[model samples]
Target: MMNNFSLLLLSLVTVTGVSATWPSDWGFGGWGFGAWAGRLSPSQERQDEVHDVEILKAVVTSMAEWERSRRDTTRVKRADGSVCYSNVGCFMGSAPFSYLGVLPAPPAEVGTSFHFFSPREPHRARSLSFEEIVVPAADALQDAVVVGPEFVPLQQDQPQQQSVRGRRDNAASDDRSTTTTSSDVAKSTTPSSTISSSSSTEQVVPSSDGSISLTASSLDGSGLLEAALNLGFNASLPTKVIVHGFGSKCSLIWVHEMKSALMAVEDCNVICVDWEPGASLPNYVKAAANTRLVGKQVALLLRKLRTQYGLDPRNVHLIGFSLGAHVAGFAGAETPGLSRITGLDPAGPLFEAQEAEARLDASDAGFVDVIHSNGANLIMGGLGSRQPMGDVDFYPNGGAEQKGCSNLLLGAVSDISFLWSSSEDDLRSLCNHRRAYKFFTDSVSPRCPFPAFPCESYEQFLEGECFNCGSQRQCGNMGYYSDRSPARGPLYLITRDNEPFCAHQFFLRVENTPSPAEPLATHGRFEVILASKELNESFVLTDKDDEVMETGDSLYRLVVAHPLMEELTSAQLVYTAYSGWISSGLSSWTVDKISVTDAFGKSMSFCKKGMILSSGVPLLVPLFPGDCNPPRAPGGLDIAMGPSISINNELPSNASGEELSASNVNRTASPAPERPTENRNKTGIDINISLHLVTTAPTSV
Candidate 1:
């Protein structure tokens, strides 16, 4: 005479072998399974409620628009150069395909190609240098589909959503193996607290003339992060992805399971994360160089998540497998607001060779966990068979007992997991280290990994091997292993959240004022910029503008292709002031003129947020990873700080309005006075962002 609840619990214990002590820090101290089972604090409670509310708000749509943002190659030539074979349906038999549509023409091979939506700007597609490449045999190709909302990675999503406030036991692991259902999660740990402020110490990603979109935020964090998520949710999807990570050389079976898991979730946005090599088409580069460059790129991407996209820093997490683990961990370390770091048996030599700051560890990353697959780690020796994989000293599982196929022929997206259950078999699951990752605290299900073993409480799960040592497929072996693949939905791409720092790298607040007739309400943070610079001989500025620049006119322009480009509401003249002018301190009101035809030039209204931008008061912030010499925090922001003008004698004009009259700004008296004995230019304007924000009203077209 057993009841449904008892029977269900019995099933859970029998199938998963979980302990009674589940859901530790999730505020559910040994409580049963239920949304309201946990006893969370006000903050935790509020966060939980907010997530649930968002879960309700999210509605799915076709993300066909976003697909255009990335380059797609339906087919590529095989090295054997035989036929144009496609990777469609079940693995088509391997036929030597010489050419594919995914790659561009020969011109694209030599010329640098630029991506409008990318913050990386003016990128040369990995390289289309047109040479011999890994020939794809028809059988080698696999049908690729984007995962929908159901596939978002919670381990990494927590940070993007601002929830990585404790040990970052991100359930990130390189566990995809022979089985279709197997997948692994990395365990991470961290103290409880969210980090939203940007650091003044970190260097901004240098501004680029190439098409680059930036993401910047401040105070409590808001901006593109919110907009993008909203946009993602609005797209054709069942759900919007909050975050995701990337791995390498995964199996087809793994991909199937991952898609299934994602399909299980409703209205979820899947944020797909991959390495540089996964840039649509395959272009090989030196493993060492690619690794380092990927790290920097990851940091820059984080800036975009914050300033351009509006993702909160504390919600950011890292999930990677093999070399991907190195990339994710290194990038997380470089980012200022990172919360969690999960290493799925990080490529040993590739990661371990670096200094502690650059490696994935508790000390370096606020929260970090590692899942050794016996697949590869220093414990055994030598980098995984995959190219660019590091030496064994770094990853412990360098030798025998490894399971994952050691082929360097898979996309990072292929490694997502379907069933994120607790079972540390082969040391892949149930390992004490793996069990404690930050995500474990949020046990969605109440039972522990060793349910069948009959552990009465959580303390036993922790103290005994039963809790930390069960695998999805195997009950014994110690290598990390994934028992299931992530179910489908959207392509879960995980980027960082909003960060106050690195505005230069990405767009922050913009003050776009198009036409005086347009209400200030139409003015928003993200507006297309129009420069008034008269294009002349070398695309440089000329004193007169009677003639438009010719095809050869040296008009080197920068375009931001990001959807969040409209967030830059505060506009500033981007010009190098004339050095010989009598108005030494004041820069001419010059800029790259934009036209109404611009994508962002359309009329749009927006709301302004309060910023401590000029708080000029400095505060202590964490240093980015690889801090050979971390920058010191300022005691306070110095609001009194002003731009460096050529002339120290006369103060610039301080105007109350957002703009200066064209007549006043269009002065041609540049040659009138010399620097030493020039006019008494005392118009007195202090170029302090703080003052301008308070005094000037919002402007827009």
Candidate 2:
């Protein structure tokens, strides 16, 4: 049965005669069933087979109709007085196809001149010869089919001219027969430049002339509305417009998840913008160029919503991911007083170096918040921009390579098995690039507040230096509530690797105090395990680099605890000495105390004076609270709190000599030290621990 299904897919590809190269990173070994046959159950396999067949049939019919439209001889005059055979011909003469080839001269009666503003040079208008534009018959098959969760075309041995009458007839009889050709649909929706379809199940159609489609769906799963003044739209509610990036459509799983999340959080109008025809794969440069036109369409829609329906522009929030981010920016630029725009890892390739007017910037809206999840250089496999493009930028875990995306093999496997997974987000590939929307969706109705601190750099933030959000730098929420934050500039925070990435953060400081007999500077690592009734998690304060810890040195780390621990019951300390040839004997170190500060400004100190820790041993210590208040001397003078001392022989500056008696000396309670035990549990720490630590004092006071 699996072999027959694979053969059927291959035959369909052969019959369609649509041959094109797919992206190398798509991880397509071959059109064989071996990759997924064993992973999916019988029922899932049957459903996938049926779905694949339907998609292939639709692709064949759509391609056939597009070809017919491309070959049509009827000339239509555009509003700009340019004559073109069809909508596809008009698009062929546009700037996106500039690199294709020159067109032949036209007749004296026909106008062949086509003018379009170049994306690279927006200030200048260039005229191109479009007397008779001819797209290569073989290369004209540019549309990609959705196979499972990925957008890829079927592999074929060679391009062959074959009839698609059977597929077209089958598609016409199906319930999805309303799906029309790209050019046909573009003509029908040209007046408003928006397509109205069911947001729940909109078929992605190829578009030309950079035309945009809008699908307005409410929480009740109502069908698409024609305009903002339609009965389906409620002017009283806030509006959230979601735009997808290049090589993606509005009906994508992530787009659906985001729309659902936003609607679930509040009663709002969710408008999903679909520009797949202009933003399809194989021509990233063309898609980048089309963003400007799509942005204009979105801006026009917002204007109608404001003027016709009395919807305030301040209540409109545009959320765009990747290249779509810039689309929202363009719209925001046109529509003044637009409330906010949230860019999720805006595209980096063409627009990263472009001017602010051409890309997403803070000036585009009243407030712009950007989440940069994969902002590394393009040469390093990053697809998102690293530059700050908003009023408040968020760089979660440095915004480059995200957690749980380090293993290339794992990501590839996830992509291949996407169909079998229960949740599409869990098995999606390009983990870092796609994480921006996931984070934003999770933040809509979060389990806890996703607080991010305004810091100069993520490295400094990890050292517990930027714990306080003050007048200089205010704290910002990572997701839905970021616009309400007073924070300006780049904010940094750490999250878990998986879902519910938000974690309770705490600043932890451990002071190392050694005895006179022991070495002043010991070389080892310290691991702190915080245990609560809800969860037990461990975090390392130092790396395995044989770090030297002097007697007075302190280690600071940002502890991110998940499962929402209300109160920490106890903590376990594990010390491992660096095994060197000269120091092969049993090594030991003494710790004074551990201090923890929560996000709410509450501080707790756990003290056990002269607690000895040996190599390869774990010490389970109970949570013993210690008073951090300064003690008063016998003469009622305050004693300055300093490092813990074994003996206090000095007197207060204003105290008399007679008052310096032993009974009059200030004393503080110290918890009894616990002995190290030889337990070999070797439990691994949670994914929240970043493994980077700061040993020196923070530069900022």
Candidate 3:
């Protein structure tokens, strides 16, 4: 008579097509599935126990080492050995329960360089030694739901396992012919892992408590339709499918944060795609390949939703991060009329330089927007693509080095601060890749608009040459509400280093010389003050430490809040030069022209286009001199503008540059001493300044 144990082994071997017998000296050779039969010899059992114990110890030790190195205050080691540190989940267990749960290993042809989770059947009897059990590689496991104290992918190798996985595979291939025939592009189903019994796709519907529910196990078209209706998914509302990146689960903090923000704005159906079965860690290449299969499954789900309900394909939006970004692109390619797709710093390592069909591109949807926050070298751990992959690509803060990620001192403080809520990966790092999604989440319902200006490059943006938005170079907003429908090409913007990443933007053009003569070089800081009917504001502008400017015509942009003004009044600017670094090595500054603009789309020309104003004694020159009056342009020290000014020889040249000194240049003396006889050889320098308005009112407000 066939007993339950024998029957179970036979059933496993039959379903997975894996033989029941494997070498007992598995550790000495390599890992493989084997039959569990009669009791083992005492020596053999002892060896198995020792090997299992050592593996468990190694896993646990690695987890501890990682946690200690991170030193994140939020880290907590659960009783079950799982560690939730740095907001990234880490599952650890003894002998059978591995970090990511049991998953079928990749094919033997791919080499045995991969490490896998403990077992797919974690709920099996613990008394039965792992050596006495049949365990398949991760690529062979199937099923999508198995709720328990700790969550892991479902087990589908059993005889009673449903055919959902098989149907999902077929749906991926079948829907392609019906959906993508018009483009004449062959629809290739995403390559799935051969080890698993089925695919690694799961469907999530937003629940009433602002949480999401795993409603569907497989990608079966019919099953998806049933689950969609049961979950109260409204097909009338715009559908947003949020896909996660490699080694990430659907319940990640950023994923939930995005879901909450999206649902709060409107009554829409937010379907978060959960494919953790293929998104496991320690094997990034496997996860990369799984994106395609998972993406096809998503297309299948969308197709079912459209056919079963009166859903419009044009209203669907796909947003993906890292590898998930490419997944979204694949989905867009399969389904053709997706309204929009947003790539949050799409992964660059393997996807870069790949063909259009192999990665995200503008053709993937009606309007595609991408945010590149970490586009540095691969050797530096940068994971974002540098190539423009969307209709509107934003390179905030130059799109390579991010703000707030550095601050060696702050990082040390945060390591001790129990309230460390930000991801540890972002702390004390300049180019953290995850900021793409963080910026997007805040922009969904931000207090201030994240305005992006169309610029030639990040370098030009810093120089403030690309602010004019009308005919020359049109600008646009970035993030969820960006006007990508009409916006084209890569856009550049700047952001603050802390929370509330938005910053006020202004573009200024400085005319440094009036003639073609050799331009003067000067180093100093300047401040702009505005007087209006309602408010008074001041902004300071300075070159970066390494940004020395040679006297010449130049355009620059400033990101700072300006005083609110319905109508133009008057503006004034004050420039103080560093004692030893001024043009001609003199203690004075020369100005030729000036222009001004505010964040509220207001523009005002300070002086006549080519007018020259010099200061022997540093004094404020009213830009809109005619507009300065009683209630219109309020209080400011009136200083006369002239082509030249005289300075006193008695006053020392080492005056503090922090403020303009009234005594050094003799403000009361109309004409004092002439330039030093030796200094007469140097010519005066001219500076032109223009401010271009950049920020726009938030769409929601």
Candidate 4:
């Protein structure tokens, strides 16, 4: 009977013009079966129902053939006769045969049941019971089974039963016990698996869509807080919940790093939300749709915490990355008075132009701060939204291309491979997109304050036009301490390419003096190289256009340096002239003086009248006291050298100046020290000024 039914379905598929291979045009509401299902007449719909039944029968009789038929795609090959493995291509290729069903029933499994429903009427499902039917390994692709637990709608007036499963932790206790509720009967029949917490016997069961497991950590050093279901959550401490994005699990290294940083800074409860089952790979659209359900699950968890442990919603902070950001938004929306939600580059594809309720927005929490690291358009290979979705949106380095992500184009292509595998190495392609969380994590225990200024655009901020904190002190911090600022709009800042991205910002001004011997306007840019005891870094002071610097003109720029140098032993100037049609031999310019102001408002000026700067040559000038005179006072009298700005000062107590490498820099948050007012000798200050350009490799954490 099954063989005949399978043959009949095959004949009908041919008559209906259904290709033997998976259809490429199928999607959530795209063409193919869904479009045809909507237009079918009553009689045709009945025929479709028959086809569905026959397909189920085929599942029982010819399971191997069913799997093989989906793989057979000779009829759907492209013009080049090659299979398309792109996300859309692979998704559409396998979506048609995908079904919502269960594994075949085992013999004598009396209580085993499965849900059956047409794709067109997923919500109108019915359960089927089978006895003594031996099912083979037919669903090779795992497409027939639902990704998570089946959603059982609550019946009116019926109590909702929830089952909690626990395991025995060998180290914590020797008690071997199992607890079960009425809902265990339903859980036993489902295909969901269990994930055990590392420090406790608590088992997180993700049986249905939106289901999540939470692992709690606190500052007591016990590692786990024991509570209802052994969740071990402390109600007195502030709670921070971290949610991972698509294709990521809660066990990610960055998540743990952030958790450690949060705990090191304050005594709080850190919870990592594990939603890997619903956010699995190969079907991004499905994962995207699952976020709504996962968000509701998170809201449910929060409510449980509040009821069981008295955790205040206002004391809870949600930090989510990519799609998880929107998930946090949904959870925050459901649980009113959420204290804060920090979105680390929210996913852009389906949520870019979505309404406030659909994505992370200001109304989701009391304060919504977002860091946009890759905000370019989707077609242009940007995974993050460019739109401002939070109350205080920060666009670091313009928020599209990061300084160290040179293989952005290659990374975009590699992102497509995520449809198959979710390897950590694949993250190298998403360097810019992942930087949002890295920046946030670093800000938790920063070496220096990650200050960002209010600005209309990054261009205006880099020009040093928006350095002031304004009358309201509207400047904001970039990461963990963002709420300290009163700013309520977009903020801009610059960051380094590697670890310890936070830097001390300085506003530099170079004044050109008119030299009668060589006074022709020069089309060139000046590069300022700052030298200290530990490191030497260079930055361009002029725009990329190489704007002609006329005599007596002053150029201003905003530059950043890490491992905050307190005093400078020497400064080097490199001038590069743009090659033009006309040639001028050995072009030189005269600089009257150079001035620098640190973030603390301390200013210093180095005077060297008639200092000649030649193109393509490095000019070193002494910055120590007695080697160069200070800027003259307004009345031409020499200014007293009281509390002059110093560079190349001593390293912090935690850092070793001689052995400090980029990787070993201490990043623990600390207050900036007061500048030294004591005078220093000009001699014995070893200044190494090598024009070595440093490039940092892209890293995941």
The TM-score values for the models, in the order shown, are 0.26, 0.58, 0.53, 0.57
lDDT of 3 at 304: 52
Model 4 residue 487 CA deviation in Å: 1.3
Error of 3 at 137 (Å): 25
Q: Please write out the lDDT profile of model 3 over residues 12-99, one tens digit for every residue.
A: 2111111122222322111011101011232332221222222222223333444454466337543332221110011122222222
Q: Which stretches of candidate 2 lie over 4 Å from their true place?
A: 1-231, 407-429, 470-473, 514-519, 578-586, 622-701
Task: Give one digit per residue, the lDDT tens place, for model 2 in 78-143.
Answer: 221111222111122222222212221122212212122211222112222221111122222233
Instruction: Give lDDT for model 1.
Output: 0.25
Ranking the candidates on TM-score from highest down gives 2, 4, 3, 1
- The order by descending lDDT is 2, 4, 3, 1
**Residues 356-395, candidate 4, lDDT per residue (tens digit)?**
6557888778899999998876544577898999999999
Point out the worst 10-residue segment of candidate 1 by lDDT: 493-502
lDDT of 1 by residue, 412-517 (tens): 1122221122111211211211111111221122111101111333234223322211222112111111111111110111111111100111111222222224
**lDDT values for all models:** 0.25, 0.53, 0.47, 0.53
Collision count for each candidate, in order:
185, 1, 26, 10
How many clashes in candidate 4?
A: 10
* 2 or 3, greater by lDDT: 2
| Clash pairs, model 4 backbone | 149-207, 149-208, 225-232, 226-232, 227-232, 567-646, 567-647, 567-648, 568-647, 568-648
